[model samples]
Target: DAYGAIRANQGLYLSSWGQLGASGDQLDLTPARQQLDSAYHLSDSLSQSAQDHNADALDSRQNLKQAGDDADDRYGNSEQLSDADQSNARGATDSGGRGEAARMKAPWLHLASPAGITLSTPESTHLAQGRSLSISSGEDVNIATGKSLVASISEKLSLFVQKAGIKLFAARGKVEMQAQDGEMAFTAEKGVKVTSTEGRIEINAENGILLQSGGGYIRIEGGNIEVHCPGAADLKGAQHNFGGPTSLTRTQPEL
Candidate 1:
């Protein structure tokens, strides 16, 4: 048989050999000789405490391997199947072993809701990793609350966009970034611009600052500014003003 069923009119009352119900009544339920001798039979059922006709619970702990690898148990095989045994089983099922294909069904567990479904628990809920956990939706997947959402990472955190670039927007508050003991870098393939609609665009560094492009650089260290250009240096303004004493060691043509 591929499956078995046990139907109850009110509720299902089930427990292990050493456990009891809520009323603490002892039920002498023993396993058969074959069941006691099976490798998958190694389990300790804690208890299933339920009222007469209200709820149902199943508490048990078994060997992890029994749950992970029980394909032989499902097929009523006590041990690993040899190549001949597998061929014989396939021959008994159908032509070209197509009988095995009948066992394959849809592998997804789909949950649809018009009104949503929220999960709430007083204790912690964890998703342990077998491979990885992925979340996807047809439209938007959002995580938002009235309070803050914080993520503390031990290693690096990465965000990638295939088409549209990433955007960080704060409706009321300002956006701030800091690197305590390391460096913060932003690299773009095209152009990079720092703009302020109403306020000023300011760049301040405690050590120094360097703005370089096309083999030229403008280095600002302490109170000194060094400008180097492989091409022509252009200064275009209505008025040329220098607050402090200016000295031009080498004068080149302005273009």
Candidate 2:
């Protein structure tokens, strides 16, 4: 009768007989339902290992708050590139101190100084003819007579014209005269005439020329004469105006 109650409970019905009592009564209920199904599968494997340790501690606190917000956005972009390199080095030192104070307050029209040629005092004086004047000096240039010296020197001018009456006219221009060095006799007190049409004249003197002429073939004409004497060439009507080697005395023809 169910193997006679598993053979009268062979010590809780394992088996004494009953023909091994229904296979030891189903192996005695399989170890008490396998210890209640291994304590309900060890409480569902400790509740899935406590929900995977609370999802790995919330993914390790969101990866430590995204690594502290990427180190505070790289320390605020390095303090805005260190305040834009100190505002471009203080605006290039305030634009080079306002360009050296506008080049020391500007003003110097024209001046050449070593102790000479610095002229700018035009208030009004008069010497207006063709109007052009220039002066150059390395040394010694004195022209003093109410100062109205005009010039058009194409070349060659050696000066020592004192007594102040310089009206140097050279419509064709050629002059070379020298006298003024210890002064044996230098007189142009108001007279030194030099006129030129075709321009050809030469007068080198230790003292001579009290009126002469030219244009009569040998009467002293048309330019070109040479005279150098150590003693005498005093002519009245002339013998070819006493040619060179110096010797002629015939004075007495001027009243």
Candidate number with greatest lDDT: 1
Residue pairs in candidate 1 whose N, alpha carbon or C atoms collide under 3 angstroms: none
Tens digits of per-residue lDDT, candidate 2, 113-175, equal: 223334355586554535333232323567575855686766334433223435766465455
What tens digits encode model 1's per-residue C-alpha lDDT throughout 142-246?
A: 887678889898765544443466788899987877777778878777988888899997676666789898999999876789999999999899999879766
Per-residue error at 57 for model 1, in Å?
A: 39
Q: Give the worst 10-residue stretch by lDDT in candidate 2.
A: 99-108
Q: Which candidate leads the pack in TM-score?
A: 1
Where does candidate 2 stray beyond 4 Å? Answer: 1-102, 105-169, 172-176, 182-246, 249-255
lDDT of 2: 0.34
